[model samples]
Target: MGSSSSPSGGGGGGNGSEKEGNSSRPRFFNKKEKSICWAKAETVPGRHPERWRKDAADNVVCKRLFNCLGCLCFEYDHIIPYSKGGESVAENCQILQSRVNRFKANKDEVDTTQLKGYSCDIKFTDKELDIIEMAVYGDVIRPGNQCRCRTVAEMLGKYKSKDSTAACKLPQSSESL
Candidate 1:
């Protein structure tokens, strides 16, 4: 939205800037507006058309998994930024993966080439996507066998397995890669 005026409500909520003037407009795009932003993008061929847009740095963004991290969950971005008087409407909205959006926040002058520089080049497998979904949203459907994967929280910082004995020690055998 290059012109003035913005929707009064948006679920994603703006960058939380309480600044006065044009910057004090609706920052985040609403659900309907988010969908409109997605609709404006080019879809990846042979992929789920409604769920997936064209690939960005080998990352896939699913509309249903908005705002999640790692597995390329995405958010509706302001193309021209409300802070600079950009309106909060479909024309000014663009969908960006969570990581990329965070890296590109509030910048009005970014191009597709620059987008690649701001993207993630890692490509994950289907099973990895499931694990990512589980870690981020804890909503993966495990078909059978009860396999426990460590949550990101447990994997971060200090971790001591409860299943281990009081004194846990690794074998001195160093395996070469």
Candidate 2:
């Protein structure tokens, strides 16, 4: 599914301004590109949860608190640093926890060698991936942006009760998994 050209059909350079000979800044991922990236990232086994939950108890003390059902939130991350010339494509984006994303910053690429160790039996449909991405990245207060979790919960249907929580719980040690 890799394309030589960007989804925008532009093939200049990382900044898309190579042809013009004016390379100032890297090009930002458009909405559609971001969506595609998020969806593709979600399909990876052992990927981080698309959303995170901070219960009311946890929210009372957390530094950055969100007020959704169970304080659900999501963050979009670049797998490779844009500053390092990583294109904003599906293969180079990931959904990460807010705290993890903050700690990661524009440092280095995430190591995926360990992902093979995690056994993930869950399979998400494209629509489900889209909803999860929107819930985590979309502005929650706006009319259309509100209640993304509810939409996802509905899509999950029977599995709603079982998978409602999307917390990012870190393993304590290599043996924890």
Clash pairs for candidate 1: 1-92
Per-residue lDDT over 1-177 for candidate 1, one digit per residue giving the tens place of the 0 to 100 score? 221223432334444333344555555565577667788777754444565674333357766666656546676777787657777678887777777766666677877777777777776665554555445443443333123445445568467556422221212348321
Runs off by more than 4 Å, candidate 1: 1-24, 55-59, 124-177
Which residues of candidate 2, in runs, are more than 4 Å off? 1-26, 43-71, 112-177
TM-score of 2: 0.35
Error of 1 at 141 (Å): 16
After aligning candidate 2 to the native by TM-score, how far in Å is the CA of 112 from where it should be? Answer: 6.4
- lDDT, candidate 2, 1-177, per-residue tens: 111123442321133234312665434454565456444542333222333222111211111222111212234445666656666655676544343444455667444433222212244543343444444554222222232344445546744444444432223457433
